[model samples]
Structures are given as C-alpha cells and as structure tokens.
Target: MPTQLLSAEQSTALGTKPHYAILDGLRGVAALMVVVFHLCETHATSHLDQVINHGYLAVDFFFLLSGFVIGYAYDDRWNGMTLKEFFRIRLIRLQPLVVLGMLIGAALFYFQASPAFPAIGQVPVWKLLLVLAIGCTLLPVPLSMDIRGWHEMHPLDGPGWSLFYEYIANLLYALGVRKFSKTALAALVVLAGAALIHFAVTSKGGDVVGGWSLEPTQLRVGFSRMMYPFFAGLLLSRVATLSRVKNAFLWCSLLLVLVLAFPRVGGAEHLWLNGLYDSLSIVVLFPLVVWLGASGHIARPGTARLCKFFGDISYPIYITHYPLIYTYTAWVSATRPTWQQALPVALLTFVTAVALAYACLKLYDEPVRKWLRRKLPVMQ
Candidate 1:
C-alpha cells in the first residue's frame, strides 16, 4: 500500500521507492480469480472441462511478481543488508499468515469431512496437531502425514505448498541468484523458460498446473513452474525501461482476466495445446502485464484507493482462501449440486474469504509485523 516494500522504519533508513500501484491491483485481480478458479474447479470432472480453465496460472504470475518485487526492494540493498536480515523481513511478512491459515484449516478440518476428503474423519487429534505444528513452520510433511488424503504436503492447508516453494525461491535468491550478473541472469532465465516449456507441453496432464506435493515428479513440476517467471521477473526489473501507459491498470486487468478465464485451448485429444497456452501465458503474457502495470499511473483518488485496498489484502486472501474452498469442495462432492443450486453458496464462500482475509490483515498480520519490526534489530 505504501509502494515501498519496506516497513516505515526501514523505508526511512533507506530512501523510499515508487510503488507499483497497478501491479498491486493486478495481483488482487489474480487472487480473486484464483478463488473463483478453485470454486469452479470442484464442479469440473477434469482440467478439460474446468471453468476458469487457466486459473492455476495465477501461481506463476505470483512468482513473477515476487521476483520483480524482491529485485526492486532488495537488489540494491545487499551492500548493507545481511542474508539473515533479509530472511527475517520475509518471514515477518509471510509467516504469520501461514500460521493462521493452517490454524484455520485445522479448525475447519473435521467439518470438511465428506466423500471428497475421506480421511478427515479418521485423522486423530494428535496427528492433526502434529500437522498443524509442521504447517506453522511452512515445512512440507511427508505422504504418511497427509491426514486429508489429498497428498498435499500441508494437508491441513493445501495452498501452503506454494508458500513452501516461495520460501525456496527466496532462499535461492538470497544465497546466490541475487549476485548473478545481468548476462548470467538472462542465461538462467532462458534455461528456466525452456524447462517450463518442456514440462508443460510434454506432461500427460498438460499445462503447468501442479507443484503441490513433495514427490520427485511433483518436485519437477514445482521447480519448472517457479524458475522461469520468477527470474524473468527479476531480469525484467533489471532491464526494463518505463514509459507511461494510459489506463494501464484497466487494460492489464482486462487482459489478465481474459487469459486466465479463457477456455481450455485443446480438449482431451490435444493436452499439449493447453500446455502450450500455459507456457505462453507465463513466458510471455504475464511479464507483459506486469510491465504495463508498472508503467501505468493512477490518475484519480478513487482508483488509487482501489489499487491500495486490493494490494493490501491480496496476499492475505490468497493464503487464507483455500481452506474455505476445501469445505466448498467437500459440499459439492457430497451433494453433486448443479451450478444454479450451488451458485449462492459459492458466492457466499467468496465473500467470506474476502472478509476473512481482510480481518486477518488488520487484526493479526499488521500488528504482528509492526511488533516484529520494533523488536527485531534486523528490521530496525
């Protein structure tokens, strides 16, 4: 919301940088789409028929944004900042919500017991507590710890898998990638792009729609999905030139929705076609949107407020929304309700997710971060 990624004290110590208001707004747009995508996912028999067909790409877009933001915020700061400091900042920003999301999932775990999550009823209280404790640390639990039977690394909160990968990306950048020269970074980006294409187009399922588990194959999917957009975003930040794009937020948001909500590119016969679509979206389209959003300006107070609001809650909603979706999925699985019949509940779920995210943001995340900033010498 403040445009600079740093806290107020840190921003003062370091000079303030311009905030990408439009990019923040675009992130919110994608976050909302993700919620819709997950909701619609329950109704689809498979990826081929899923409504909001490309919503999974939002994760890739998020990676890109994270790279861009990390570069923008910290690329120049290593001269003064230690890796410990950087990790502390990231954990302060991210971990509180991770803990809360897992707690919410644990709280709602039993209620979600249905045909879809067959193991939920059978999971003992001790196992649930163990999973919750591991989840609070953002560590991946093994398959034997998967009490939900979905094979998620964090079965209590499925979306925690992405956060696990996100931390890996942060560690990679902090440890070595941040030091790469521009030419070397470009080479890395190109190779990552190739891996992404190979995985998306060659996989039997098609599309870059995985990365939620810890198995060898799923690990491949996860890394392939992460490497490109993130480093591409980092490269773009280094090399990008800015020019004003009028109404950039509006146009970029529209394009993002169009691509994400577009129908599957090829049906069951041509899985690779959808995979190609996924590749193009992450490899080409997502960065374009980020560039445009970065280049644009907010002309009106109302629009500025809108972007700020969306940007502020974007991460909170994303990290918290899926637990509700797990419940919705269970409901849909048990009842097999038609779209019309389920429409109201789905809408309510969406609203509830939004409200819950905002509540967590104000009631917990902000206060905790403020406390961390004051108490942690690194943040100070």
Candidate 2:
C-alpha cells in the first residue's frame, strides 16, 4: 500500500499528509460505538448486563491506534523537532476539545440533578469551578472533592481520564520511549501486555474497565490498559508490511463493530473467561483491525468521502460527546426508562452529540488549531 497522493488543491483543502484513510474511518467508527455504548449504559443495571457489552475496549483500540499513528507520523522526525515543539503540537491538536468538554460538563452539571447523585443539588458553585479548573489541567480530582458522586478524576467530564493517559503516553514518547531500540520497545510491550492480561483476569469485574478513578487498584487498571496497546501500536508502525486488502475498511470496521457490540463473552459464573476475551481482543484482535485498515487503499470516490468525513469527526465526537452522555445517564437514572420509552430521547442524544461534535470541529477545534499553527509555527 503506497501512500495516497493528493493534488495541490485537494492537499490545500484537506491539509497536507499521507494518512491511513481507512484507519481514520475505523477510528470514527469506534468513536460512534462509544456513544451508543454510553447510551446503553443508561439502561444497564451494571457492567454485566450492559448492552454493547465490550464498547469500553474501544479506548484500548484508541490507545493502540494512537501509538501507531504517532510512531508513523513522528518517529523519524524527532531530529528536526524539539520536545517542547512536539508537546505544543499535541496540545494544540487536543487541548481545545478538553477545555470545551469541561465547560460543557460544568454547564450541564446542575441540570443533571437526579437520584443517582443525591448530593448533586447541594454541590457548591465554587466547588464545581474548582473541579472544572482541575479538569482543565487534565489532572485527577481526589475523592475528598468528588463533585459528581461518580468519583471520576474529572467528575464534570468523565472521559477526560483517557486524555490524561494519552498525555502521559505523549510525554513518554517525547522524553524517553521514542529513544528505545526496537528490541527494548518490544520488551516493554511484552511486559505491559502481561500486566494488562493479569489485571484483566484478576479484576473484580473481570474486565479492564477501571480507568476513571484516582484510587490505587483503578490506577493500576488505567496504566495497565494504557501500556501494552500504545506501545504495540508503536511497534506495529515500525514493523508493518502494508499489503493491499480489498474492501479493507468495510471488513475491518465490521470486525470492530462485532467485537465491541458482541454480548459479554462469559456471564458472572465465569468472569475470568470474559477477562480473557477482553485481554485477547486488546492484545490481538485490535492490532489486526488496525493492520487491515492500514494496508488498504480507498478505491471508490464514495468510500473515500465517507472515510474522510468520519476521520475528520472522530476526535471531536469522542472528546465532546461524553458530556452529553452524562446528561442522558442522569435522565435514565432518574426515570428508569425502558428502551421503548427512552428510544426517542436516546436517538436525540446521539444526534445532538454528532451535531455538537461537528459544529465544534468546524467552528472551534479547526479554527483554534489553525490559529495555533500560525502562532506557534512548530506544530509537526
């Protein structure tokens, strides 16, 4: 799979780069599934019963995918770049949405007054602001100051925790991991993958779904989840042999949806079996999905356009949509609405999230990054 070339006008309009377009489409596909998963969570009494049972694995997919992209994009360019410059580019690309997510979460905090969070109504404005301030820095809030009753690092924006780990990944790449020899990186990935497997199998819930808290066990889950896939992705980029695959995007996407949308592999009686499923999917299945996506070229005009649309919206939709999920979660928690009763409202939440993400991408994220690129001039 040779790099796709763009004409001058197309390059100008879409920005310059040789991207794995199918990979972009896959990412967008995963992001959309995440929203559906969160919506289904509203109806679930617990993780065991949740629909879209394995959607949390999308974050691991994202981590692996991120590492691969970063390696492919940046690994050879460090000679011409500084650590400060690298951090600046990542921040410009990612931080605007972080700020927007926190703000949206804060705005909707009170409106989400429901029985699940009985103390929600009594939470102080200043405390909310304090949490917002911390969240803006992408730092975890302590249990003492838990504002949303979920004890999430970012109570206002639950998904901010992933971004926090993402930042850590970037920092490691910039400071140290990028310097490792392939053999060293492989060792790291192997160790991390083992730890991830152990954590998944032994986890109380028998899944690696615990990345939002600041507590010790959850912190282990977060880092365990983060390490293997991110580094494996990096390794994949270094070693990938890009062979042409027919209808690769369609096939890869179907696999992704099936994995994420599949029912829990094992019920409560055999939790460890499900853990094995989760670990294997992250360590094995996800990399295959990414490889298939990367090895193909988009041949059809319609498919190319579709991948472009999804690729563009993927990050914006991901970072911005969780705040809306918070509101939906509140609603469902309060009303205990059946799927039939909640169908219309759930559909509305999905549309609103997609619409909001698109609007923010166009009006806020893109414009901000453009300006940052102009002013900073070192975004690579």
Candidate 3:
C-alpha cells in the first residue's frame, strides 16, 4: 500500500528496465493458439476439439497477465498517482489503436460487397456514428445500437467484446479496488455466484459433448466469468511476495497442479465445468509466470525480444483476427470449390492476420500511444 518501496524497486530496475520476456513469449503462444483453435472449429477431432475449446481459456491468461503486468509496472505509480492519472495512463496505452481499428473496420464494411452493412442511401448515419462513438469510449454499449449479443461488430471489429471487459476491469483496478480487501472479497462472492449460475444453466440443458449448445448470450455471460481469474492473479501477486520454495519438489508440485487443472485439451462438458478447469489453469500458470519473471528468465535477449513484440501486437491481433479470418474465408469460398477443402486458406488467413497485426502495431498503435502519453502526462 505504500509508495516508497515500489518506487525504489522501479528506480533500481530502470537503469535496465525489468524485461518480462517469458510472459511475452507466453502471450504469443496464447494468441496464436486461440487463432488455431478458432480456425479448427470445423474440423478438429474430439480430443483436439476439446482442447481447442479450452483455447477460449486464453482470455483468462490475458486477464492474469494484465494483473501481473500492471502490478509489476505501476505498483509504484499506484501509491502516488491519483485515480485520474491511472485511468489516463491506461487510455493512452490502450485507446488509440482501438479507435483506428474501428475506423478502418467501418470503412471496410462500408465499401465491401458484404451484406453486413446497409447500402449507402439506407445507412443509419447517426446510429452508426453513435455506435462508433460509444464503442470508441470506455462505456459498454451493447444494447444502445441494437447490438444484442457478443461478436456483434459494427461492420469490422469483432473482438470488441473482450475490449469492453478489459476496459471495465482496468477501470476497477485503477480505482484502487486492487488495494481494498472488501473489493477483493466482493469479487470472490460474485465469482462463486457466477459459477453456480453457470452450473445451473448448463445442467438443465443436459450433458452432451458433441453438439455444443451454449448460446451467444451464454458466452457473453462468460465475460463476467473473468473476474475470478483476475482476482486469482491478484491473490497470487500477494502470494508471490512470500518466502520462496524451500525445495525443487515444491515448485514441481505447483507446476503439476497447474497442468492437471488445465481443461485437458477438450474435456469440459459445460461452461461450469469449463470454469472450474480455467480457474485451476490460472492458479497454476500465475505462479509459474511470476517465478519466471522474478528469476530473470524473461530478460534473456532472444526471449525478451519475442515477448515484447507479441505483447505489443497482441491486442491488435485479438481485435482484428475475426474480420481477417472471415474475409479470407469468404474469398477462398468464392474462388475455390470448397473453402474447407483446402488447408492453404487457414494458413493464409493466419499469415495475413499476423501481417496486419504487425502493420497496425507499427502504423497506428505505437504512434498514437506515444502521442497520447505526451498529451496527458502519467505521473511519475
């Protein structure tokens, strides 16, 4: 809760800023895995499909990583900085590219031969602008523009739903809930209630593996499902501050727990079961990630570069992938006899997503972030 210790740690590290490369590499792995999972939705085998569905668990990883990274980066700032400053820093870091992606996406929808958008004469200009405006801001405008469920993109950006949660989570953290015991307790209670709700909902539908029946609405509810993982990370941040393991066996045991809990490549029968698996996965992964970070593994030259690069472009890839995937799939479907008939389309879509992510990172994300940083200074 005090600022002095954190400030000292930061100053000492700044001569060479603490590099969390392993975490970055982990991020790259997570993002790419999600892409593969989504791509394989149509053809993957039972075991593989089970594991692939678990790919959605990557969102948990992101939330955990966010908690750890924010704690690592701004713990010092937290002690001294006002809530406004904290919020401003997050905006500067996260908002610009989001806006750019939405604008570009909107344009693509406007001109493309897709049925997703209204024709020029019939365009609801004010409604469209309103969607963009609210979307570009921190507010979650799901029902405002008749956007009812998850995956409803205003023409272009599909990953917008996750961003909504990310923003909300960040706001709660910045507001100093992370420092409050009551906040943490409340989070746990909410998570328990959510787990119960998921169990009830999933059980009534009957337990069948193959024909997945969770609605888009059910999946949307899963977003609230993330608070558990986030708090778990917070709890681990505190746990990590304790005495180190006395033996290699202890660390090994922790590692084993993590792996065992990971939703075994595709085994969960329902969202509730999935939630249990995910919670275990985070608990296991969080400590390992922290230990790796603290031990200087992330600072290894090659590993550091890989992590930093992925972490930088990770958001763009997440936000832009659906459109890129859809567009690529559509083109392949039109040109070829059967889109899924060719393996090349999947590979091509992946390559294109990575390329566009890199471009967005370089052309829009970094520059706008820097400009915003200059425009609204973050307290040191």
Candidate 4:
C-alpha cells in the first residue's frame, strides 16, 4: 500500500496539502476488511467457499489508491526532487512498519507451530533468523528458502509480497512511468487491464490469487494484479474532475464493503464466472468507489476524527495483523473449533490486531518517521 494521504501533522511538517480524508477513511475500511477476510479464511476449506471472498481485492484497491496518491503528492514535484530522493521518501514512509511486521512475525514464529504450519517447528534458528533479516528488508526470498511450507515469498509475513509489488510500482513510477504522456499512460493501462482479465478469467482456479510465490505463473499473477489498478488510479488522478458529494464517505465505504463482501459469483462448476467478477470489480467498481471517496469532504468533527483514526491505523494494521493471524490460523487448524468455540478468540484477535496496530503507530511508526525526516533534511 502506498502512503497515499498524510496526516495533518505529517502534511504540515512536510508541506501543507489538501487531505483526501474520505479516501483515507476508505483505505482504513479496506484494511479492516482484509483482517476480517483473513480471519474468515482460517475457516474456509477453499477459496470457492471463503468468507469475504473478494477481500483480496483490497490489495488491488490499495494499489489504485497508491497510484492516485503518488501522482497527487509527487507527480509534479519531480522537477525539484531526484529519483533517489523520491525512493528515500517512500522508504521512510513504508519501510519502518515493514521491519516491525517482520520482527513481530519472527517473535511469534515459534508459537505458530501447529499442524497448519508443519514446517515452522522444524526451521532452525539460524535459518529463521536469516529469513527474518531478509524479510526486514522487504526482499522476497526464493522458493527454496520457504521456511513456512506455505511457499510465501516472505514466510515471516505473507502480505509482504504485495508490499514487494508496491515497491516495484514505486520504482517504475520513479524510473519512467511518471514521465508518460496522458495518452501513453492510458494506453499502458488498457494493455495492463487486458492482461489482468486474461489471467483472472483463464486461470485454473478462476481467480487472480496466486502471487505470493516466485514461480513463473505466480509472477504473472503478481504483475497482472499490480499493473492495471495502479496505472488506472494514476490516470484517474491526472484527469478526473472532482465534485463535492454529500455523505460520500458513507456511500463509498458501503459500496466498498458490498463489493468486497459479496459472495462467490459462480460456484464450483463455473470458475471463470468469479474471475470475471474479480476483473469487473477491480477494473470498474474500485475506481468508482475511489472517485466517490475523493469527491467527499468530512463535514463533522466526529466523522473527521473517525476518518483520521482509521487512516492512521490503516497501514500499521495491514502490515502487522498477519502475524497474529498466523497464530489464530494455527489454533483453528489444530483444534477445528466450532464457531461458538472460536468466536471469543476471533473477536480477541480482531481487537488485539487493532490495538497492537494503534500502539505500533503511536509508539513506533510516528516517532521513527519523525526522526528519519529530521535526520534526512531532504525529506523536509
């Protein structure tokens, strides 16, 4: 996820810019859905029957938001900023939590040794630390280095795969894509959208879900998943005219939840049906939601505070929640508990994830980013 909208303090410290408060709130909404999606995933026998089926699309939505935010925040500033400076600013915004997420994963690594993650118990300390070190850098490990048996690029934190792609998108933007003419960028988006549809509809599973691995097929899924939404958002930012919409945040958030929580479109016999749904949602619905969100303004103090809280915790929760999920998944797999049995713990996990994320944000993320900006005067 790109650090799309900055907090009031951050914007003031850097240079004041108008806030997309509703977009920030929508991001927080998506991030929470991702947690719920993963929690519900532990109970799913397969993706076909998974609860919050399209929650994976939140990552795609994030890419879209990232593109819009990057374009809005930095597209014009390149005249004054070097590529290295841009990368450094991004790293300062993103890398601190990435390191903390990996650290949390490593701290809880041994606790999650149930049947669900059979390999965790057997991983040597040296090897585990090695992965931890690499994961802290947000670099993808090879499949041979898969210590969790899930074959995730970063076994310590599976979601790091998306962040890896986030970095790639940032790199591409800095290197050349940022310089593309509007027409050129739109053409690239069309091609990328075509690729996304092809992968989603034609896949054996009929979903664009296998991007965490390093294999060729997975790599295609990864790139296809990233390209269209990011560029589309970028394009939208450059071209779309904003009109103030009343209750836009509520309407957009509800739209996001409806699309994301909508049930599987076609069941076992018609896999491509869900793929088509996936493509449509990403290609059409997400951008609409983003446009509406961008058009919104916070009209009340209570609503404004809610949006700010959600925006502040959004990234931290997304990056750090999965480690808790690893433990919860292990418990579910090993125990096979009924919903009644698991409800309390599930609620606890949700609450704890939110609490921990907020704690990390206030205690670590804010302070570290502040220190970095101070040390690197160029960021200021």
For each of the candidates, give the backbone clash count: 1, 0, 4, 0
TM-score per prediction, in order, is 0.97, 0.96, 0.72, 0.97
lDDT of 4 at 233: 93
lDDT by residue (163-246, candidate 3, tens digit) is 666777777777755676745645673674466345434643221121111335444454444565565555555556533333
Q: How accurate locally is residue 225 in candidate 1, as Cα lDDT from 0 to 100?
A: 84
Candidate 3 runs further than 4 Å off: 1-17, 42-51, 110-129, 143-155, 181-223, 241-276, 283-300, 329-340
The per-model lDDT (C-alpha) reads 0.88, 0.87, 0.54, 0.89
Residue-level lDDT of model 4, residues 197-307, one tens digit each, is 998998998888878989898999999999999999999999989887888889999999999899998998999999999999999999999898888777777777788
Tens digits of per-residue lDDT, candidate 1, 1-380, equal 22322223234335656667888888899999999999999999999899999999999999998898888888998988898999988887889899999999999999999999898888899999999999999999998898988778988888888889899999999999999999999999999999999999999898887888888899999999889999999999999997888888899999999999999988889999988999999999999999998888878777777887788888899999989999999999899899999999999999999999999999998898889877875633
Model 3: lowest-lDDT 10 consecutive positions:
1-10
Candidate 2: lDDT of 335?
Answer: 89
RMSD of every candidate to native, in Å, equals: 2.0, 2.6, 6.7, 2.5
Winner on lDDT (1 vs 3): 1
Instruction: Give, for candidate 1, the lowest lDDT window spanning 10 residues.
Output: 1-10
lDDT of 3: 0.54
Clashing pairs in 2: none
* Superior by TM-score: candidate 2 or candidate 3: 2
Q: Runs in model 2 with CA error above 4 Å?
A: 1-17
